[model samples]
Target: KAAYNKYLSDKRAKSTRAYIISQGIDPKRIESAIGYGEERLLNGCDGSIKCTSAQHQLNRRSEFIIVDM
Candidate 1:
């Protein structure tokens, strides 16, 4: 299960890269996509929720940022 989740997360990051590149963002100008994988919770919840599916979905979500190179 962990392996599969990581796989999907990686795929999502790659898609984001493709998107930025297609939008005329230089591939080299773009930074790498990072997937923290449920390590940081928005609500400070340690993922104690008995149901893991929803938590997994949330963890797979991506975050982006722009900064001076």
Candidate 2:
């Protein structure tokens, strides 16, 4: 499950990056796109804890960090 989750997150990140470029954003502007799957959980939803579907969904998200204006 861990490996699969990582793979899915990585794919999502790459797809998001592609989408940004498709929208006319310069690819060079993106230094790197990485997926830290399950590494950072928003609501502390882990394997040992019982989390609601909504909580799990929250962890499965994409976040963008603006490095420059």
Candidate 2 pairs with clashing backbones: none
Query: Candidate 1, clashing residue pairs?
Result: none
* Top-lDDT candidate index: 2
| Candidate 2: segments with Cα more than 4 A from true spot | none
What's the lDDT for all of these models? 0.67, 0.88
Model 1 — TM-score against the truth? Answer: 0.65
How far out, in Å, is residue 52 in model 1? 8.1
Kindly list the per-residue Cα lDDT of model 2 for residues 1-69, writing each as its tens digit.
888888998998899999999999999999878887889878788777998899889988788889889
TM-score versus the correct structure, for each prediction: 0.65, 0.91
Clashing pairs counted in every model:
0, 0
lDDT of 1 by residue, 1-69 (tens): 545655767788888889888999988787797554445556433446564666555655677777885
| Candidate 1 residue runs with Cα over 4 Å from true position | 36-48, 52-56
